[model samples]
Target: MSPRRDDVIVIGAGLSGLMAARELEAAGRSVRVLEARDRVGGRTWTRSLRGHPIDLGGQWVGPTQDRVLALARELGIETYEQFDRGRKVMELGGQRSTYRGLLPWVGLGGLAELGLRVGQLELMARRIPLRAPAERADASALDGQTVRAWLDRRVRNPKARAVLRIATEMVFAGEPEDLSLLFFLFYMHSGGGFVRLTSIRGGAQAQRLKGGAQGLSRRMAEALATPVEHGQAVHAVLQEPEGVVVHAGNRSLRARHAIVAVPPALAAEIDLGPARSERRRRAEQGMPMGSVVKCIVVYPRPFWREAGLSGESISDGEPIRATFDGCSPDLSFCALVAFVIGGSAGGFGARPSEERRALVVEHLVRLFGAEAAEPVAYEDQDWSQEAWSRGCYVGLMRPGVLAEVGNVLREPAGRVRFAGTETAARWCGYFDGALRAGERAAQEVLEAMRAEVPGDV
Candidate 1:
């Protein structure tokens, strides 16, 4: 049977794939997008709960994330500041404290120590280039050590160590011991700085899209000249000298170029013929996605706000590691979102839906008093359970993996290219990075095609 042909075929209808398709179509190339899920928006998902739109996936947009912010505006999506007024909550060693600003009632000495560590991280991260992390002078030594090992040697204060550990879980969705220090530095550098990566005002968690994060992807898909085909997961990619063939269940698509924009772990499942190099294959095997269970609890009102709380909290010992105010912009409905990440996510996500919901509600009640027990709705999306996406946020490099095989991440295999947030240099694990990578991959494909046969594009 003859396969349908196009100029470009994109596997995955996520933001990255959609953006790549948009660019190719704008360049006068025929394109088609194939997605495994019934809907678009890979890691970024928006859903309605009790008549209020809530983002179950990646939602926040930082000030430094110019790419996603600009794209949102271009798509006519508005943004709003996160509800971060009043004092924030912190629970450490079973003690609860409320404080205004960023310190969170920690001692002056602890705050100074934390600040110094953050400064040191930022300074070291600034010295490492994003594109060539493995080529650094001390890359081998740094990659050999874990973030936990680095913290153990330098951080003496218990409070400081706890704070850093929590930050590690929130950012990477993995424990400090699970990821390499070199990768952490490169990630921080790519996101601009440590402060920008963690803060709420100027950091990566600053603003929320007016509708939802997924709205941007929906708009981009809508604007595309070629429609995205749903429930068509590409199982094999056979790359030829002049083109590539992508095969899903009973259907196959042939294209001049192909973009495998799914997660690295998922991409590893596809058969790429002789084009996939050993280095690329080994790198994909080593790159594991971080675990996270995003839970949202809708309430009658922003009760924590009236109690002089900012609806944000971090815990050293809680199933829900972090909490944030997910209320609507119009203040009509209230929602509190929490993240169960890392090892806890694995345990909690494995439980039945009712059990997980009860656990989350119990934790929220403990944090916000008895008023939190009664929620209008309790919804959670366990990314680890999804067949298409093994996990959430982004992939992580364990100790010794980055130094050995980090350079092959974005390297193309014949007519096939990669595009995802994980392959991005700037804002490596965010929606912003996803957009940058998509655009970059599209440009690379266009350049390759033009170089191969002049005026082909």
Candidate 2:
């Protein structure tokens, strides 16, 4: 069957692309989705490792993330909460404090409370818009300062700082030193603040398709009655007087509109006809990729649980940095995921996979006793090294970027609209951001199609 021509061509089969295609298809418009990877889900990839489904790519969706939750529900996918079992351990100043029988803030109760107050204050600060918020008036105060700086001044407890640091690391996948406080604030605001974050149940908290995240994309494509052409890496996107032509391998696809949903850094490489605007260029220029190394270690068993440990640990030391009990609840499998971000992750990303695995093993053994060293399997995804990804995710404004060029990313460039975690107006670096961006881009395309006019070039 000749690829069914469409009114719009949705590039990338990631969540954003799939969502865009679905939206266009629902509007009585034919659509074709071109995916570069052989499988669906793009950045959200789940693979079988050690005879179990392991999501090595995008993982976890909060409850308040309406776009993703709505899509998951639409597809009949279910999510579970991440495990917060056992006692959490914290390592500070070369001292390991194991909370054998205590609350989460046992080690730093006062500081934890203080940090909550500061967090509440920061949350209030974010409600003000970047364009009109008083915070923006003092934007210069935060521009050059990193999350570390802001937290240090605002939060007195070292343990509290560590917790917040972990949150920042997981969310941005980079050092807080590289991300803007304003951008971070906006992120919290977008989700309606800390009170709203939710995870899948059983410490298995993440809305996973009954089959897998990949199944969600597959089902979405089926619902659209569109065959997603996989392994079709888009090379060039050219504009014609009548429509747009997309070159993917040897095949050329034409459509009245095209939604460019790849990473901003990657999307910027594709040449657009009529050229992109200064604002778009600024957005693209300001939009840089950040790095994060998600290392997964499959344990022979939940040894940490046996040790009266929560499988959650924070370190001011080496190797593992932080460890989480990523195992699915039923105790069927045990997974320990460690995140190395920014400059720290860079070193790990550059190292050979085997060496990196060894380093992780050493760290796990030290933190969780010797049992952690005997892993059934070990794997790591250096998202920065993945050519298609360039980096794990998009970078937040370094001080000046967002103040001067941030809004550009939120703006559309001609017939070419952008979608991805990076382009999200809400949560720019999380799975939620991808969902929001995809849904918003779909709405943008629908609105443009309705007007019977191409969107601003």
Candidate 3:
């Protein structure tokens, strides 16, 4: 059979790729989306656990993430505030302390240092341009150092340093030593500084979808003129003079342009023929995906609330780093959401499922009470183990890598363009970023094909 034809061929059915296809469709261009997984939403996934929906992927949204928020509103998806009432728990130096509000009970000295360093990092982050962070004058110096080195050089207090480390690992899913200082600053700034990104009341983790974040992609997929072809992993591409041919399984397609919407790690699996550049290879190799395991446990009731606990916990403990109260608005569905991030995720996810669940229950028992030992249901998504995604949250840029390959990230590899959360300007690792990146890639394709139209989508 003749290869399928379209104005644009989109790889991956995640929000970014689907958004790109949406924009293309809105612009009167035909599109065909190919996804490796047999579902939409990409990293944002949700499933029913014991008659209750559980979000096991990127699920949070806030007012600051205007793109995702706007999309949610347009899609008629309701948003609810994250549950954070009663007392919060904090474990430091092997001591557990229950506190309330944003700042934990980490002592006056550590608190002061925390405020100082956070403010300092925020200020530094503001100086980095969103679109072209590498082009900034001091980019070289900033990119040359890792967050670990920068923290050791700048932060004096151990408690403050440890807290910052934990926060970075939780957010980026990469250890301090694995991330570039410049990239870290840019990422935090992209989400409106450290305070906003880390806070809950009015920050990145502020809200949740009534159903789940994955619903965004599901709705988009359903509304599209063409259905997304699932289980079609684009393994090879050949850029012809007139168009491009994308190969997935026994199928192939020729299009004026192709948008590679997967993460760098997955993108590396696609053979770009002889035109693939060494710089692109280096960028893909240097930028590694962060590790994370999103866990959920459901019980008969929200017992933590009965004890006047909010179910939120932040700790420097091994394996488990953070957790939050994840019950329904009516309090009928009681569940504890948790995360094992960074280097710890590697080891934690390697354990047998039963052991992992046991460890989480044990940790919660200590943080909450004896009630945590028994749960009606348990589930988790080890993002690192996913074949299509490889990892979660977003890609990580190591020290010295950004300075060299950052410029080439958004540029087209011949007839192939790129889009994902990593290519976004603001909220780089969030759903908003993913949408923005998709829109940007679609616009690029339109401009190249001379079909550009203003106010599209």
Candidate 4:
């Protein structure tokens, strides 16, 4: 039998879709959420690998994140502070250097401090819509330049440049060479920069999920009573006069409105009929996603603590981009997470899994010692492999793209609404942005529905 006609049909049960469904349901609207994957959390999933629950994707939350933190608080999900134990190690220009300060660079003592202050300034700058950042009007001044170029011009110290590159890669998911200076500046301003951004204290500040993010989504689904049909890949969307139809295999759903909660790259596949414009075509082509390869190697014990280092290392300009001491106090397990940004991750893609593990193990052994090489278990995720999510976070506009067509992908198209980390105004590419976009799209739909007039009983 055909299901009863619902008030709204939301596609993709990611953080955003769930949030939109929750809001719509709270307002007494009937809603159904559809997910392409067999799981509920979409991209944000956590599972027991080997033994520990290392987040496979979409980890970390911040206190400043009003939506996610509020949801966590409501669900009673607790968070733990990041375990930043010991001193950070630096590998630059083939020489290994150990630093005992807040930042990994030397002369950056002043520039890093300035960068912190600039991040604070950037947060305040968020008051101005990203569509028009004052500095952005002059594309030659900021837009045309890559983050690496901006940093190089600002910080004369090569070490400082390298440290900033690591931070940029972590945040933007791209190298300094490709990231826009205006984008980074706006990112800093929106969230108050590096220091304040890191201090969200359980919200942005901690990494514990209590049970992990997937649990939180389940609670949202239950509260909304929204049926999330999993393993159903939406092949096409056909808009009708009264409602829109979603197609996948032999199954199809018709709703008054459809939320395109999937990422831009994936959303490109959905045929919007005549509404699909060249702008979206360019967005699908121009926007970039990070080719990220994260390796989570857990040891029988926290051996790195004995190495007189913090277990965190930043490469000056090497393939071993960044490493951190992702260990708990019990010492039963130690996680060394290495982030390979831009072209750095390409080499590891074709390598065998065991070989990939061996490569990271060798890097750790070279810096921390042979003990670091031994692992009880290892887990890795290449987000690129995900058909649903082609890459991790949305790529920032390279030089020419942002200046010419900055808001092309963010605009709404007919009855189809877009949401995800990329559409958020504040934190455009973070998990927080994902939550923000979901909330914003939900509110937009709610207001629109409430304003609608009934046609028939």
State each model's CA lDDT, in order.
0.89, 0.70, 0.89, 0.70
Best by the TM-score measure:
1
User: If both were scored by TM-score, which would come out higher, candidate 1 or candidate 4?
Assistant: 1
Tens digits of per-residue lDDT for model 2, 223-272: 77869888888887787766678888788888877888888778777777
Colliding residue pairs in candidate 1: none
lDDT of 4 at 14: 86
Total backbone clashes of model 3? 0
Tens-digit lDDT track for model 1 on 1-457?
A: 2466898999999999999999999998899899999999999999998777889899999887888989998999999999898787788888888777765556888888888898999899998879899998999999999999999999888898888889889999989998899999999999988888878998899999987899999999999887889989889999776788889888877899999999999999999988888888878887799999999998988999999888998987668899999898777889899999999999898899889989989888878889999998899999998888899888888888888886787989888999999999999999999999999999999998899888675
Each prediction's number of clashing residue pairs:
0, 15, 0, 13
* RMSD per model, one decimal: 1.2, 3.9, 2.0, 3.2
Model 1 earns a TM-score of 0.98
* Better by TM-score, candidate 3 or 2: 3
Candidate 4, residues 214-234, lDDT tens digits: the string is: 877878777776568888788
Better-scoring candidate (lDDT), 1 or 2: 1
Off by over 4 Å in 3: 451-457
Residues 1-457 of candidate 3: C-alpha lDDT, one tens digit per residue: 2456898999989999999999999999999999989899989998998777789998899977888999999999999999888998888778888987666756789889888899899899999898788888889999999999988988888888888988888889889999999999999889899889888888998999989999999999998999999889899978988889999998778998999999987888899988678888888888889999999999999999999998888888866799999999987789999999988898899999999999999998888889999998899989999998899888899888777877576779988999998888889999999999999999999988884335543
Question: Considering TM-score, where higher is better, how would the candidates rank from best to worst?
Answer: 1, 3, 4, 2
List where candidate 2 sits over 4 angstroms from the true fold: 1-5, 99-117, 130-136, 152-163, 194-211, 453-457
TM-score of each: 0.98, 0.87, 0.97, 0.89
